[model samples]
Target: MSLWKNRNFLLLLGGQGVSEFGSSITYVAMPLVALTVLDASSFEVGVLTAMSSLAFLLISLPAGVVVDRSARKKLMLWSNVGRAALVGVVPLLAALDALEMVHLYVVAFFVGVLTVLFEIAYQSFVPSVVTKDQLVDANGKLSTTQSLSVVLGPPLGGGLVALMGATRVMAVDALSYLVSVVSLLLLPMREEPPAKTAGFSWDAVRRETAEGLSFVFGHPVLRKVVACTATSNFFGAMYFALEMVFFVKELNAGPLLIGLAISAGGAGGVLGGLTARRVSTRVGSARMIWVSVLGLGWTGVLVPLAGPGWGFALIAVGLFGFSLSAVLYNTAQVSYRQAVCPPELLGRVNASVRWVVWGTLPVGALVAGWLATSLGVRETLLVAGAGGWLAGLWVYFSPIRGMRDVPTTEPVTA
Candidate 1:
């Protein structure tokens, strides 16, 4: 069936797309606001970022439990509302000339907390609303929206910040959340009931969490996917933390240039997501995964090699985007995981996998900062790039490389 025929998916995609665009604004605006407006140091900015992801790591498992128990729609709605309210505070404080780095940090923390909940609910809800046959298509379309948001969000944010100031740009982000909340509220489907257990107990939660972890690590397919994904995310986080430094110090690129570079990467992501299905069909899922991992990892190597000119920087950004095979890999992996996992365990499983995979980001960011400070930004890029490439080889050599497609029939329990 055509993707557009599914109204629930449409609303979900639309809301998520809008919300992501807003997030992209904050992603760009936050550091600029901290640095330019608040006159914060690199350390302070790092703290803000670290706090953001730290909340995700801390709250992920709990959020998964909550998502499993609660009405997913309500969870999504409340998440967006909470995020909007928190983001709105920034602009309001700025208008009163009372904005402080502390205020931004607090808002960032709350937003991150709510986002973890929203994401858990969203991921869990997808399989319920769409059939197994539609999983990859659903993921591809969602990835496309995300890619578009990435492309549009930075430039739009930059323009807004440039015109009305960073504070006002945050207001736009707040509005986007409100829109997302409404869209989710309008979704036609209800979430599947959570799996029933004998009773609620700490042991139950522990067992459930462990089950999810085992599913990811014990299964041959999931094991390699997780390894490749976790390793790639580690390096990706490092690149993200240090990209601004590379632009400013190594390339002498300004804010607009940074936005442009990000937009270029977004363009690549859009391309990857759009063609993911065809690529998977042509090359096979296993081969596609390997290609994307290698491509994404190698892109980092070229970052440090870009010349100190806009033309060269743009090329680097485009290549960086082109090398990002993760979007497709992630799309495929999520779909496969959803199809094979018991319906009742979806939330816990998704959350558990995400917790482990994403848990490395902060560590990677910290390492990137330290390495950049000690060895220089270029050297840091070289190291991260090399490490990422080596990490990709894990998937290349593993069982994941041999699998051709997700099982067409229901997966038998191990």
Candidate 2:
């Protein structure tokens, strides 16, 4: 069946799209609110950005346990509701002239916690909505909108910020969550059977978390893919942390050009989503995983080559290539993971991958900051560009290197 005809999938896609669009708006507005209203310094803004990813490292293992045990749809609904309330507080505090940087910090941290819960459940829940064969198409459709939201959300956010205030713009973000909640409520219940446990206990949580980590590392293909993703994310985070600073200070790019360059990444993501299934089918899914990175990922090297005048296009092209390869790699690998993991362990397995991969982001951002101070922004980008391309060698050297298509069924257990 065509995903366009799948009503439940459509609801899930729409809800997530609305939610993603809102988050992208906050991505722009949150830092601006801190910088303009709370008078935050550049260091403080960096800390604020780091706060959002901190929960992934801290609670992702426990979150996997929660997703495996609970109703994923229910968890998603509450996660959205919680995010809405947390984001809504910003504008309310601003109106009362009581908003502080500390308030933003707390909100950002707690919101990150909810996001961890939502994402794990979201990935685990997809299988229940579609058949095993539809996983790629479903994920690709979801990715398309996610990329589209990133493309459109920021410009709308900047405009809304100009017309209404950064704090007020957050109100719109909060409202987007409500839209997600409504869409989620409209969907029918998921078809997957609930996972049974020996009941909840601290010991059980510890054991379950360990099981998740073990499952990911024990699988031959999963281990290598996770390593590649982690390495790529680590350096990718570094590249992004310095990208804007490099453009403004080194390339002398104004706001208009800067926005255009950032938008190029979103455009590339859109293309990747639209093309992933076709590309994977042509290139073979297993082969495409390594091919996407080794083939297209090296374009990040173009970024450090950017300069004044016509040279600014290098930044745009580089970001476009990086985003394109990332979305392609992610779509293929996520589908493979979903197909190969045991049903009961899906939540835990997905969380384990995210924990390791996303855990590196904040660390990489901090490293980028130090590198920029030590080696200079342009030179730091050179390190990031080369490092990102090399990261793909993890899968290249592993068992997946020779395979054409990946297995769609869980590995047989003893």
Candidate 3:
């Protein structure tokens, strides 16, 4: 039977799809808000983005332990509620003309913390809802929708911004979390109760944190995954911090065109999503990693080379290649992790992996802003593209490059 026929999976997809779209909306609208309404400088905008990403660095370890200990459903539920309230406050403040950079900072940081909880829980929660063998298909489906969200969200947000303004678009983001909460509430399956033996303590946090970290670094496949993902995210952040600025200033793109550029780049993501499993199965998983990250990842450099009008076509062309390969790479890696990692350690492992990979984003974001201030946008993008191209070499040299399939979990290393 197809996994799509499963009711709970569908709910998970629908709810997350809605929320993803909402967040993507913010991706476009947030910078526009900073640039247009608040008159934030490029550096200030980077700071705001950095503040949000700071949570992965600040709390990812503890958050992982917490997700492992708690009911993932409840954690996700409360996390969404918190996010809803935090983000919803923005529009209210905007209406009252009371919104400020400080408010954005506070919201970004706290919401980021909740996001850590939600994402760890979400990644850990998936295996409970499906058989172990179905993981790739499940991840592929989710990734496909995720790519679709990227394809649709920006343009939708851009159109709304054109009509309703960015604050209103943020309000829509808050509403999307509510939709995710509803989906969580309706899930037919429940997260396995956290192992009774694992109790809470500062000692437990430190020990378990080490265990999670050890698993990621100790495992050959996971180690490479971390290296490549971290490098991509770091450089991606440097590029992303300046991307909106690039579109507006360098290409002289309006909001719609900016959305188009991002969407076009991701056009291949949908294709990648649909084919990742098939391609990886046909070739080898390790080869797919190199192909996706190394082969397609470098195309992102084309964004800097683009000009306005017909010349802007380069962004879409580059994005199509980059996005396709990235989605393929991610779906394979995530499925491999979910399939191989021990259940007791899933939350911690996911969090540990995220800690290393996502933690770079803030640093990258801040650096991009600073670089844009001193070096300029195109140069920053050039560096970002080249960095992305080289990000996967660690994988190429590691055992991950030679593996035919994900390996079984190894004994926990001290």
Writing each residue's lDDT as its tens digit, candidate 3 over 330-368 gives: 888888888778888888999999999999999999999
Candidate with top TM-score is 3
The TM-scores, one per candidate, come to 0.93, 0.93, 0.96
Query: For residues 367-388, could you state the per-residue lDDT of candidate 2 as single tens digits?
Result: 8877777888888889999999
Clashing pairs in 1: none
Q: What is the C-alpha RMSD, rounded to one decimal, of candidate 2? A: 2.1
Each candidate structure's count of clashing pairs: 0, 0, 1
Candidate 2's C-alpha runs over 4 A off are: 191-193, 247-257, 410-414
Off by over 4 Å in 3: 196-198, 408-414
By summed lDDT, the worst window of 10 consecutive residues in model 2 runs over 405-414
Clashing pairs for predicted structure model 3, backbone only: 265-319
Query: Which candidate, 1 or 2, would have the higher lDDT against the true structure?
Result: 2
Candidate 3, residue 70: Cα displacement in angstroms equals 0.7
